[model samples]
Target: MLYISSNLRSLRSKRNLSQLAVSDAMKFGLDQYKKYEYGKNTPPAESLLVISRFYHISIDLLLTVDLEKVSIGDLVTLENNRIVLPITVDCNGNNLVEVVTQKAKAGYAAGGYTDFSFISELDHISLPWLDKNEKHRVFPLDGDSMPPHNDKSSIIGKYIDKLGDVVDGKTYIIITKNNEMVYKRLNRNGKNTFSLTSDNSFYNSYEINFSDIAEIWEYAGSLEREQFKPETNDINNLTMVIKKIERDMVEIKAKMA
Candidate 1:
């Protein structure tokens, strides 16, 4: 309830709405609404519901989250007080997506992901095709663990706050607290862990505890940079296999001798 007063004031101020105007919109008495803003009295649950609906924010968020510390975007629907990522837009009102590339992943995992200043300072790009209502980010991947996504190609993901919404066997960008950033297909390993498997069979699957995860972004789309001319060197692959077989035969002969 401590954040309620400041949140009320902050929301109103951001919209440039007068107290009377807000009160009239919510059908709340001006004095009562003023009391709520001034922290003189806490609104009843019903009144809070009215305000919540009017603001299009969850009651839990209104009562708990410090609005001043966060930049609110009406785009993301807040459910059960889940963190609403600050959504920024360009001058033309197109949503600006902040990118977290392979090089900056360590910094991002080291609190830059949650720090407002750090997020704002990162590079941004605008893509109009994505749903404007959802929060999105672009992550450029480099590894061959997930094939078909050309190395260094970028993937756009929608931010999902609740872990419950993470469906099994879906690809996602998982950021762990241990400063690890990886994109892999996921499954429910248990009540508190996620089983991650790479699309490429060369990489082994592993499980990550729920407690270790910092953020999970659902795969939305990709910006795959098509390789103009691919190197087709099957002879090298055959040579390696032949060498491996020759080494195995030599080891067997040595053992027999």
Candidate 2:
């Protein structure tokens, strides 16, 4: 409401961060980056946290006030005693896709990239296969557990939530036993154990005591769907390799049970 984006842009300029630099930190390409600063996009709560942390400010500052209008340095203390500073967030979508693909090739996916996907209130997303409606969240599938799904599809697009809001049934992108990344529904059994259920029969469930998870970041919005595509025939080959990797990863996980 306070044109906070203008303040952000001003502070970023003062700090010598070009628009490209900010985009890199946010994992957004130049186009998405421009849209963010221009207020065409609003980041999620997690993203807001990351941005505020980068500026050494509370979320309140970024959400409600503009530091530029008050004749302050990049840093500012609000009436509520919150601090704000200029920060840079940047990333190249194409490069990220390549890196992520390579990670899949290596049979693992690391956690570092933040989710940028979002859903609008007015949007309608329905899945007949799961008998669900109006439940949706854009999740970047990290590995090849769903090779058919990721093939010809960018990892950054919107995914229909067939499992609804039930926390345990919520499908999540998680690390499997053999070190590959995957999307699986999380289930909590009565015994302090959690199950990683995969929809693909080729990949089995990963059941753990729920203590081994390294980190879990919830899904956000869809990446701009049209942004990525593999340029060569290697995509198909990569897909096959990833599918086999995911299968082996799942087998190893099932054995851990």
Candidate 3:
């Protein structure tokens, strides 16, 4: 009952290819390929593999998913039993890093990240330091929860496809199911949760369930809106100076004693 005839037809149409053209590329008789589009017959496994390779799509997706409704990013393919990302590349042969601004943050958290139209509408930049093969996205920071990356700044995050790749004590931009987007230093709490901590001690740390995390982007680099000033009146800065002074006085007292 799960026929791939429609899916095949949709993909071909999307690519603006005629049935005859596809059949010629596949080296199959025109009549035989027509049967596949007409829902009278299905392609063999070998033929399916050929089609998948030609279209740069996965066989599982070709057979199971509605290609018309799914975006390229949402498609997952298995190579050697490992999942592969369908990263989009620009015509200039450069990988595009999509920027998630404060205005678009809500849409991204609400599952718009995987929508082709939504993603296309977002502004993109190319980073020379970033590998063309790696998937990346940029997110804007809103609060002073983390120093060095204060309000009006943005962090470029490399897409973390698997949860097991998350490193302890590293910073990440976490997107939650309820649209809670935050940048925090991460620590593994257990198998299913992570301890999220802000650099500023004033904000208490807490644990977040992995199930609530919709997406995770590992911190790669940052862009500051304004020139960084070391003399900012942050409470953490004053606290650190006071603590250093107190430690120095204690050392002097111990030496005298």
Candidate 2: tens digits of C-alpha lDDT, residues 158-242? 2221222227776565433334455566787765566777655555676765434432323332333344455438776687578
Alpha carbon RMSD to native, model 2: 15.8
lDDT of each: 0.77, 0.48, 0.77
- Name the TM-score of candidate 3: 0.61
Candidate 2 global CA lDDT score? 0.48
Better of 1 and 2 by TM-score: 1
Q: Residue 96, candidate 3: how far off, in angstroms?
A: 0.7
Q: Cα miss at 146, model 2 (Å)?
A: 3.6
TM-scores of all predicted structures: 0.60, 0.32, 0.61
Higher-lDDT candidate of 2 and 3: 3
- Residue-level lDDT of model 1, residues 1-257, one tens digit each, is 35788999999998899999999999988999999999999989889778777887756568766777756565233233323344455654445789877677678877577555567777898787888756799888867778778565888988886778899889998877787778899999877788999986546689988877877899999887785345437995577567767877887999999
The regions of model 3 sitting more than 4 angstroms off are 1-87, 231-257
In terms of TM-score, the best-performing candidate is 3
lDDT (C-alpha) at residue 152 in model 1: 58
